[model samples]
Target chain A: GAGVSQSPSNKVTEKGKDVELRCDPISGHTALYWYRQSLGQGLEFLIYFQGNSAPDKSGLPSDRFSAERTGGSVSTLTIQRTQQEDSAVYLCASSLTSGGAHETQYFGPGTRLLVL
Target chain B: AQSVSQHNHHVILSEAASLELGCNYSYGGTVNLFWYVQYPGQHLQLLLKYFSGDPLVKGIKGFEAEFIKSKFSFNLRKPSVQWSDTAEYFCAVRAYNNNDMRFGAGTRLTVKP
Candidate 1:
């Protein structure tokens, strides 16, 4: 089975510009999550969708950061007016179901976004 | 809210040497623990996970983790390591009642052949 996949393996953009990162989760995965990985921050959860509905959005750093999933398959994370601090690899993951403590998540290769 | 801490930032060892990486989480409730590994240029993959019943969980590539509830720790260990085992290991925890999962800063393990 194919694992999660992300688009635009590398992206370079100017500061204050907007960037959209795309993620395609595995087939039949009902839960999708987005995370940001940087040198020091490790991995920071951005947002998650459970069957097209996000139960929690608090993980998003700021209002400029938003994510949406359609058809319970593809998810897009949009960073409006991106800053230098937002430069990092954006990762996407998915599991078979949601809200299970024992669920194992499969990760994508990630999109490396560079804000210059 | 939950937080995870990886005590070791980096570890270096020779091939066939024993390995241990510490991971601690700050949460009082029941939690599920996991170890994930990322090889150079590869995506993160599950090493193992501990939910209940057994305190020791074995994962791929001769990796295993012990969940100690009394100490709030889940340490990953392996008796013998290979050069191919060099990678970044991340410890993660998810509370029983929460949908969100917390991850540690990760430990970089370099195995010298």
Candidate 2:
């Protein structure tokens, strides 16, 4: 039903501050994703959006990381200047578009970010 | 760098016992395997997936997985285990011509009943 939905489950910025993480996809999900889960690092893959052409930042890990997917759904993942290694646990996922079909992402209950 | 290897970060059993969990990955071509579960704070569910003809795949509740392309592995088993099947197990890999997906650094099962 209503799955993927993330927000500030927890965030505590400090180092060079600049954070914004949100994602709400699943009303008709046309695909949207952003992942991060540090601490020995595992699930990492930062940007993606389908159904609107451009956006596959190729696992964005630099450029202060950036992400956006609006109009097709809500998604945001901006981590400008934030460091301390950008903390971790920022995950959002959705599926239902991406042509090749293998759908099944649906996740959200993450947003730990803590860079003190 | 398509990596995914969950060589057990933690696993303690007791319930009905019997359950294996080990996933290995490192692409060079086709791949699509998954086994995700997270029952503590919840949010990451999908107990099975192995995009190809049986290599021993069955999922949900009494999960199963075994896709061994020689040893790129994709292990996850269960013969009996329940303490609510303690949680946190993730093993993912995607690249069949893709937008990318990779995960695995999780394995926290703790089934003690």
- Local distance difference test scores for all models: 0.91, 0.86
Where model 2 places Cα greater than 4 Å from the true spot, the runs are A1-13, A17-35, A38-42, A47-56, A66-80, A83-86, A89-113, B1-14, B17-31, B36-51, B55-63, B66-77, B82-87, B91-95, B102-108
Evaluate every candidate with DockQ and list the scores: 0.68, 0.24
Per-residue accuracy of model 1 over A1-116 as CA lDDT, tens digit each: 79999998999999999999999999999988898999765688888888856447878999999888887789899999999999999999999987554578999999999999
Position B10, candidate 2: lDDT: 91
Task: State the TM-score, rounded to 2 decimals, of chain A in model 1.
Answer: 0.94
Tell me the tens digit of each residue's lDDT in model 1 across B9-80: 999999999999999999999998889999999999999998887899999988999999999999999999
- TM-score of every candidate relative to the true structure: 0.97, 0.35
> What is the DockQ of the complex in model 1?
0.68
What would the TM-score be for candidate 1 when compared with the true structure?
0.97
Model 1's alpha-carbon lDDT is 0.91
